[model samples]
Target: MKWSKSSRTLRRIFTKSSIGQNPTSKGKWGTSLTSHRNKLGTSRVISTELSPSSRRFTRRMPFHHNKSKKEPNGILHRSQAYVAFIDETFKGTKRVPRFMDDNNIVKGREAQRWIVDTALEMADAVRHTLGPKGMDMMLVDRMGNKVLTNDGATILKSLETKDPVASIIAEVAKSQEQNAFDGTTTCIVIMGELLRRADELISRGVHPNAIIKGYRMGLSQAIAWSEEISEEKEAYEAGVEAAKTAITGKSAEDFVDILSDICSRAAMVSSPSEMMLLTVHGKPEDAELIEGLVVLKGPATAGMPTKAAGNIALIESEMAPPQAQVSLTDPDQIKEIVAIQQAFLDEIVARLVKAEVKVVFCQKNIDSKMLQLLRKNDILAFRNVRRNDILKMVHALGGQLIADFADFSKSDMSAATVEVVESAVNDYVVVRGDGIKAASIVMPAPTEQSGEEFQRALEDAVGVSYLAVQNKKMVKGAGTIQAQMSYRLLSGEGCATADNSKVEAARRAFAEALLIIPQTLAESAGMDLMDVTVKLGNSPGLGVNVHDMVLEEMNVFEPLAVVQSAMSGAVENGVSLLRTHSIIMAKPIQEIFAEAERR
Candidate 1:
């Protein structure tokens, strides 16, 4: 009965050996704030009717710091510890404390439907914005910054709602975005239809428990059905298909194949590759891949050539004056220290010159003297290189990382084809060689805002495609997979023969819920649902042609993992709300303290 939210556990830790034997012994007692009790006495938390006005008492026990090693548990004061003491005194029997309080309660079907309805209220706004024809939502926050997007997570999160149930639903959409990386809108739409079907069954006198059980049954069948119909393509093919499907409802509809191809290439060469966006005074359609690793830094000094090709030397150590790193407290030795530092730098430059090394990449700082020495030796050097870039460079240039400045072994040096190119405002170092396995896709937009938006969309496409390749599974998109799963569960072949009415009910409800995706797709595209349905009939390849407003087989597809993630998230959330009968708002600790002192 002693509940604590910090660690998320409520347990009784008895301070004294015996409660009845310790009546004269001064100590604290356990406390239970809720009035709800299980009929079978098996539930951790239960639903029972009690007046919210009922005042329950709780004692504030003093926790003194006991330094003694023998006294493990701290001392407790038994001031106003009646409720838990009485409950413990009569542990087995129903002779419990009388002051349990309840705050929010709705009895029977009303409670079941009301919670689902409240959750769906948030889902309603985002469900319509699913599929290719989905409309964008413009959200203006308190600061009045307008964000225009069709992203389900964005729309749900941007809404300012005070209802707690509504927040829970919003959390589900957000969770989908975080976990699956896409399908935020599809998840909301699916769960909304799930509750709608559950409500429908409840109106027909179906028990809420039956509907919950049936929903589970239907979910299992839907998952199995989806698993069966999933079709996979080669890495590039699958990536292109997945990428195209992801951008269906997005603003870059015209460049679907072009975007998909770039994402596919990036995914194939670089698993989780870095995307670089450059905003030029050009159209977004001019996006293309660079056949080299993008090192955003320019050449270290103007004395270094803009382009050079030779054996590379990668130094993980600093190029600064070695004597500067040491301390010289005496003023008289300052000139001596400077001469020693200059000599130290002179040796490093001499070694590079002897080894015939062309370009030098240093992880740490380069002193001005060392820069001059390198330039004097006709060797190009870049300073303060990023660690990731350094690693990629080693992999690309086929070079070894030199940790010691004194060792200039020929084995440590490798080949590097370096070019310092000037873009609109900044310079970039493009490092490429035969050994590099990755590629960089650079896209330029007409404006900074448009370029950034395209970059974000491209990132989503690339991420999903990479995941699809790694997972090795996919499902037909354009609402085809959802349609198949829907038909499978609703056909009565998936769940009717189980002889359990509850499972049958859940299966039916689940099957009906799967139609939400295709239904929304049809609505968004302004096509007749019946007409689209007839066109896609039983063919796994056939999907809605969003562009031409016809049903045709196209490359629209999605990762199987994406659909699976959305299904699991939606079912878990819907069932959690379905099982609830009441919502409780606990009184503040001060109110309980006031009541305890009065007692």
Candidate 2:
């Protein structure tokens, strides 16, 4: 009765059969018939026919079925057709998969090798510019910007490089800057020396691990020695010694005097706790002679005389009375507050009149009423003096508050005493003249805005001095000696109080020196450290170029299997070079890596 459905279901099951299964079974027939009946509907019935060849066949043909002679394509057979169509559509296209292209692959092992080599190269470039007698590098930027300085960090930072290895060298240079704040050249030279030593080991077929081990040992010793060298009992003494060391065999007395004077000035103005002075309207040259420190208590806008010769009367407070705080949130509040504070201000003016204080410095804004009162009392008052100027003015005022009001008189004016005198320019006061006047040269006070620039200049001068000393030692030339003398100045001794700075500087110098080794090797490897630096400096997109160059030049073998392997090679080579050579070679190498990584 349902033989047609059964026979159709059997055909479906046999078509789906794989390698193993029973060809005929009653249970299979039952299951097949049920599945076919459920899909085709219960009303559909199977019909059977015996062909001319006596083969029995079942057919369940609905009204929609044609029951044609052609056989249906099997599920597996249709799948094959679909796959063929898809394959044809995408044939001969540029969609082939690959792993080692510029966009995807990073030849890390090659980069590591290049980095190590470039580090050594850079270290060697500045090797001679080390120690107290180190030479300077004249850096010229791409825009033809010229910088004549011996600071190792400055020189390395300024150079253009593209090698990944060179960037690593630059890091070492930066490390020097951070560690020493000075003697960057020494650090780079030391790095170069170490790198050279590492190269020697590599050439000799020594295991990189062994070389790295030896280098680490040497670095440990060098670091200890560096710490010892930087250790100082007294800041002033250390400053003097550093100066002498910086200028040895060339105007010894002048160098000592100059250093001492700077130390003294730093101590006086910056406080004995810190050996650095910030001037808003003065230069280092102005503080050449020890005239005690002063704090001018006035407005920041008030201009002081560039040079004033005579006994100076240093006023600790403004010539004008203390200003009363007034809320000017409302426009009308200004007039009312000014009127209300006028009476109290007049009484303070009376004291200044009696004291005959000529120049007064105010820490607050000057109201019209106070200005009028001061004018009537014939007192000159300046407002908003900077902190540095306040210190200088207090020292010049003979330690007296001009106003003598309770609020203004609270500051310690003992340190504000000054020598007052009449000068050709104007009536002036010197903070602590000691009766000595050497052509008063007025200059703008040092302020936060200009302090960094001035400090850079000072650092450059020091670097130049270092270079001159180095030149003398290297070539024994009279020109170098003369140059040293030209820059030399007399200063006092045991005046500085910056112990931490000296120690830090020493530490940095040693660290920097240690970094120069690998840089030299990078240079030897023909890596263009400058190009790498320039690309990194200009744009991050150029990092690809840097990475490519590193891989092309530094990889020892083809088809690096993993990135870690390359990284290990680089680190090992870099560390080994640093240990064996001076940092002079290391500076460039460190710089190269720094540029590439944007570090």
Q: How many clashing pairs in candidate 2?
A: 142
For model 1, the stretches where C-alpha displacement exceeds 4 angstroms are 1-122, 139-147, 153-181, 199-212, 232-234, 273-281, 308-370, 377-416, 433-435, 467-474, 494-497, 527-543, 547-555, 576-599
For residues 1-599, could you state the per-residue lDDT of candidate 2 as single tens digits?
11223321233322323213322223222332211222222212233223333233233322211223213431121111100011111111111111222233223333333334555456555654433234445677678766554445666886687544567667766654443334444445544544545445455555545555544433344323323322222434333333343333222223345644354234323322112233344443443423454332322222333332332223444443346654568868877666656766877666545544554555545666677765654455556545455554443433543444654332323322344334333333444444222112122224543444344433323332322222211111111211111112101111121234332232223233232322222243445656533333333112121223341222111011111121222334456443332221234677889899995
Candidate 2 has an lDDT of: 0.37
Q: Model 2 — TM-score against the truth?
A: 0.38
Q: After superposition, how far is residue 513 of candidate 2 from its true place, in Å?
A: 10
Worst 10 residues of 2 by lDDT: 79-88
lDDT scores for all predictions? 0.68, 0.37
Candidate 1 lands at a TM-score of 0.64
Report residue 343 deviation for candidate 1 (angstroms).
Answer: 6.2
Model 1 misses residue 132 by how many Å?
2.4
